[model samples]
Target: MTVIVQPTGVSAADVIAVARGDAQVEISPAAVEAMATSRAIVDGIEASGRPVYGVSTGFGALANTSIAPERRAELQHALIRSHAAGIGAPMPREVVRAMMLLRVRSLALGRSGVRPVLAQGLVDLLNHDLTPWVPEHGSLGASGDLAPLAHCAIVLLGEGWVLGKDGSRLSAAEALRTAGLQPLELAAKEGLALINGTDGMLGMLLLAIADASHLFAMADVTTALAIEAMLGSERPFLPELHSIRPHPGQAASAANIHRLLQDSAIMDSHRDDLAHAVQDAYSMRCAPQVAGAARDTLDFVSVVAGRELVSVVDNPVVLPDGRVESTGNFHGAPLGFAADYLAIAASEVGAIAERRVDRLLDVTRSRDLPPFLSPDAGVNSGLMIAQYTAAGIVAENRRLASPASVDSLPTSGMQEDHVSMGWAAAKKLRIVLDNLTSLLAVELLSAVRGLQLRAPLAPSPAGRAAVAAVTPFAGGPGPDVFLAPVLESARAVVSGPELRAAIEEAVGQLR
Candidate 1:
């Protein structure tokens, strides 16, 4: 697939296609023209000998220093080299690709005053599947992921490391040579434009939104199976119950769980027992409320991602009126706050899911289900340890949910006094979502086992399909086997697309 990068902006879908899939990226003709127009403005400024913040002068704390005309290109090169000081492990290939793609998108918008060749250089890297070796650390998230983007920018100059298509690390110059491309010379303002943006944090946020969206749907599916396994009432998921509150997410989640519970044989077997089953505990009944709130938070995060997709986040932006002015649009507070907010919401989703797992494994709370869903209770040990794992993950997620955006430290001689720890937020949010996936997987394993112990009673079609999907992971209602493999297998299934597709096939797409 080829994703055309436009001068106006790209969509979240475009970002995903190029970032996650093997989609090639192309700069639209209009974008090239826009870059040309902006390039002319920059050239004029250079000719006029104006001391622009990034063009003829030094950057950050050294903004007051002026550079001679002959030394301007050197200044740009030096900026990329000196700033490429990131530490720690290399960022994932997908993250580097996404950051590279977004940098091109920003530069091609004609606001950063870079030549068409500069943007094309980044596009070439993506088209050839060459990912720059951006390190995991060194971004404070304000002044826009400087060190991280600097590492990416240096690759365009053919002076850094790049991971080749085969995941082999090669020098950027060698990679560019093999791909029949040449290193781009850093032009005035071009190097700063390349490195000064929220691409790193923003890319991570976009990917998280995509992953979180799927997990949210999976959370709904898991909630349905858990309810059925617990022999809980489906009345709480009724459309009428959510109508008065009318949070779109709550309604959607309630509707999805309600649909999954339709014609449930397990639920029907105890339909007349409602008088005795007054409530099924908050974990079972409030699934939608918790997961629904998380869904809504994800929606808001998506909205933020959409806005950032179109934002021209750079310092010293070139205006249509032919004026060059510095701006603070590069600040990452928006992305940081969004990432943290989603983390908190996602943490709660995992928290509630763990609670459900606890309920399913508890002898007292599991209705009449065998202890730990094991046929041979004491000898089997069953899924008892799975709940402990979920609890541990939930606890870690709680710690990870402590918003990274709130803390700030001064940098660049305090010129960057209050930085947005957005990159940290995005990074931790990724971890939280991953933990949430495993946490939910444990819940899924326990619930499916509980459904297995329910036996001849049968489950809803969706529940039955879910159980069938996970059956490959382990045996049904048996004495404990090597559970690590079982839990790992369940995690694989939960993290993949097959389980979701199977359930949606039986019950239609989840909300």
Candidate 2:
């Protein structure tokens, strides 16, 4: 699939397509014309010798320094070269691709006053799968991911490094030549436009939102499995129980759990045992409330990401009337706040999941289930260490959930004081989500094992499907045999589409 960059904006779906799907990209004719129009205005301003911020003067704390016409081109080159000072390991391929695509999207809006060819340079890189070697560190997220974006921009000028189509690292110059493309020569305001935006953090936020959305649905699925495995009542998920509070996500989650446990033989077994089944633990009973709150956080984060998609995040934006004015559109506060909030929400979900995993392993709390769900107690440590792993991950998630946006430090000689730290927020959020995936995987596997222990009484279709999906890799109930591989396999199944497909096949579509 090809995503056409419009002057208006690109959709979040398109961003994901190009970022993760390796979809082709193109600049629309309207966007090209817009770039040309904006370029002409920049040319006029340069000819007028008005000493514009980026066009005629230096950047950041050096904004007061004036430059002669002969040195302006050198100034732009020096800007990219000096700012491309990011240090640390190279970022992931998908993240680099998203940053490149987003930068092109901002340039295509024609608000940054770059010629059409500059935007085309980025598009060509995306199309050729030549991702710039952006580092993990750098960017206070106030100057709009300057260092990381500069690493990307330097590749446009063929001075930095890039990951080639085959995943081989190569100099940007060699990679461009191999891809049959020429290096870009920046004109006035082009260099500054390239690096001055919230593209990096925004891109991460967009990808995080997409991942969190999927994980939220998967959370509901796993929560239902845990409820059934523990022989917990589905009465808590009744529609009447949630209609009073009426959080859309809460209602949807309750409905999903209710539907998943519809024909459960285990549920039926305890249907009349109101005395013993009067209530389950908070982790089992309040599943919807916690998962639902995470869902609500995702919705709010999506709204912020949606707005960022349409935003032109360059400094000194060009107006329709041809005036270039400096602005704070590059600030990453919005994205930082959203990413941090989602991390907290995801952490709580994983925390509750870990608690459920603990409950399933405890002989006292798990009803008739064996200790750690072992066939022979004290001989096999069946899933005993799994809860420890989940607990450790949840602890790490709690630490990572600390909001990076709330902390700031001065940069650019205090010209960029009070930065957003949004890049840190995004980076930690990515780790948090990855940890959550593994944490949920543990809960899913343990719960499935618990359900299997309830012999003769089969799980609901959805629950059985989940068990079947993991059985191939994780195997059925048995003595512990290299438990790490089983947990890893379960993690893959939980994070992949196969489990979702299997579950949905058994019980229509999930919420």
Candidate 3:
């Protein structure tokens, strides 16, 4: 199915589908009409001899210089070539596709005074599975991901390299020929229109939001496993206790844990027993608080992302009244701030999960589970070092949590004095989440094995289902053997969709 781009509205889901799912994209008729109006103004501005910021004059530190009409076309090409200054590893194919899709959608809003052919050119590349070789660095993120977007812009002009569908390399010109498509020649304002936006940062932001949402849901599931396996009482998760605080996320998380632990033999087994402790540790008892805060943070991030989705983020935006005006909407502070905040929240979530894993490893702390969950204790030394691995990752997350948005370095001859560093924050957020995925899996693998050791004691129905989901990947309890592969498999299960479905099969969809 095609994702239709409108003049001022595009949904995040649609962007993801087009970028990651290879869905086709098209500009709506209204958007096409809007572009026609904006383009006419740009043409008039060129002919009237009134220089626009990007149409007939120079850029950045050179904005004071004006050029003649004959060299105006060359000016656009020069902007792309000079600004394609990114340096670092090439971005993943998905991120590159997202950058292209977002730029096209922003252009479709008709605020950038671009021709319909320019927007069509981007869609053509996407539909043909031609991904520009965008590098990972060089975006100040204050000037709308300038350097990174320039690389993508050059590909459209058929001067740069691209990665084809089959993973082979080809110059954009060669790839265009193979696909029976022609390269685009930049027009009056098309160069700046194509490159001036927060699309690169915003695209990664959208993808991060999606991944964090999934991990938040899984946090509830993993916490449930840890609780049942460690014999942690479910009293702390009672709906009555959480209703008073009334943070939406806290209430939801509490309710999810409550539902997930329903019909549990584990809780019932210790119900009347006096020997069992009255409370679980903070990580086990306050699962709702830590993970719930992350949930709430995600809500804020989504709001920010949604606003950016419909924003016209170019400098010199073409207005509804046919006026060209330079605006600060191109600054990526909003995205940078959101990305940093979410990264911090995700780091905390991983930190708490690591604490839970530590508790499940110590035999005495685990309330009678075998040491390190090794079948033979001393001889096996099972999951003992696994806890260390989780500790190491959690430690790294703490370092990565230092917000990237707060740091700034001047660029463009100090004409641009401060930058958002949003792209760096985004890059770290992706890594932190990946580490968190594995951390969650490590805790979950320990929990699954610990639960199995209490066999015939049976877990909550939801906990039982969670164990079932990971058991195939992590295997049933036994002496330590090939632990890495099992944990790796468990990591895959945690990051994938099946684990949620497996748990939901027994309980309803997690909150």
Candidate 4:
């Protein structure tokens, strides 16, 4: 599918599509017009011989220095070369693509004063699957994600490295030449225009936000399965109860849980059984509240991400009326805070999931289930160690949940005081995702085992379908085997649309 690049409106899903290389990109006519208007403004600035920040003059800490017209090209080239100071491992290819797309989108908004050819080069690279090699470090996420973006801009100048479609790293010159493209000679304000934006931070945060949303749904599904496996009551998810306070996320979570567990013979049969009494523990009963809090956090994140996605977050924004306006729109605090919030939300999901896993694995805690849900108990050990792994991950998630936004160190000689540390926030989110995925995988395995123990009791239709999908890979309770494959299978069940659709179909019948 072709990914249409509309400057004012792009969805999180579109960003994911471009990152995954499942879509070709096209710069909209409006974006092209914006680029043209911005370029005209830059030209007008040069014509008037006015010394503007990063255009006729130098950049941060050197904004007072003036550049002669004869040395403008050299200055732009030097700008890219000096700013390519990013260190650490190379960023993932998808992240690079996202950064490129964001940069292109920002330019397309027609406020960055960059030439159309440069913007089109980014679009071409995205279409051809050529990704610039951006580093994972070095940006304070203020002053426009400078170091990483400079690496991207270097590719346009035919100076840096690019990963070709064949997976080989080639010189930018060779890659561009092979693709029938020429090097860009940045015009006045073009180098600043290219590198001075929040693309790096925005791109990473956008992808993280999308993944967080998916994980949110997966958390709900897994929580439902865990509740059923524990024979927890569904009365807590009643709509009338949620309707009183009526936070959208809380109501939606209640509805989702209610839908997921609607057709369970096990739940129905136990409706009158007072084995554990009238209520479940907080992890089960308060599932909606905890999970819904994460959802609420995402509502805030969505608003922030939406604004950053469509915003012209560049410095020295060019007005259509032929004026250069320098501003601090490059600051990444907005994205930084959102990423922090996302990390916290993901941590909560992991924490609650760990608690659920604990309850299912404990013989004392679990009612009517075999010790550790193992057939032999003493010999097999069942999923005993798996709960330990889940606990470890949950503990680590707590450490990872520490807000990266609150910790800041001065940079660029205190010129960049109060850094956002958004890169740290985004990086920690990746860790949070890993922990959440593993925790969910453990819960899935335990829940399926619990369902097996229940036998003829029959889980809810949705739960049964979920178990059936994983049944082939789920061997009978046996010796501690390598769980990597099991985890992978569980991930497949969680991530695959078909599996989710099957569950949804089963639930629909219940309704």
Q: Candidate 1's residue-wise lDDT over 1-511, tens digit each?
A: 8999899978888889999996999999999999999999999999999789999999999999999999999999999999999988788898988999999899989898988999888888899878898889999998999999999889888898987656667898988899898888988998899999999999999999999999988898888889899988889999999999989999999999999988777888888974548877998889899889999999999999999999989999999888999899999999999999999999999999999888888889888888888888886788888888888999999999999999999999988999999999999999999998898888888889888888898888888887887887687877678888888888888889998888788888888
Off by over 4 Å in 1: 164-168
Q: lDDT (CA) for every model shown?
A: 0.90, 0.90, 0.87, 0.82
Tens-place lDDT per residue, model 4, 1-511, is 7777775746777888898755888888887777887788788788788898888888787888999988877888899999998877678888888888888888888888888898888888778667887777888877868898999999888888887556566798888888888888888778887788778777888877777777777777888888888888899999999999878888888888888977788788788876656879999989888888898998898899898877878889887677778888888888888888889998998899889988998888787788888878887788888889889999899998999888888876677787788877887888898788788888888988888788788898878877888779987566667777887887777655666678777665211
TM-score versus the correct structure, for each prediction = 0.98, 0.98, 0.98, 0.96
Better of 3 and 4 by lDDT: 3
Clashes of each: 0, 0, 0, 2
Could you report the Cα RMSD, in angstroms, for every candidate shown? 1.2, 1.1, 1.3, 2.0
What order do candidates take by lDDT, descending? 2, 1, 3, 4
Residue 211 of model 1: what lDDT?
Answer: 93
Residue-wise C-alpha lDDT for candidate 2, range 173-271, written one tens digit per residue: 988898899988888888999999999998898889988888888888888888888888899999999999999899888888899998889889888
Give the C-alpha lDDT of model 2. Answer: 0.90
lDDT of 3 by residue, 1-511 (tens): 8889888767889878987798998889998998888898888888899878888889988888898899888999999998898887788888888889899888888888889999998889889888888878889888889988999889888888887556656788888898899888988889998889899999999989999999988888888888888888878988899888988898888888878877878768887889888878999889999888999999999999999998889998988787889888888899999999999999999999999999998877998888888778777788888888999999999999999999999988888898888888888888989999999999788888888888888887777777778777667767667878888888888899987987888888888
Cα deviation in Å at residue 156, candidate 3?
0.8
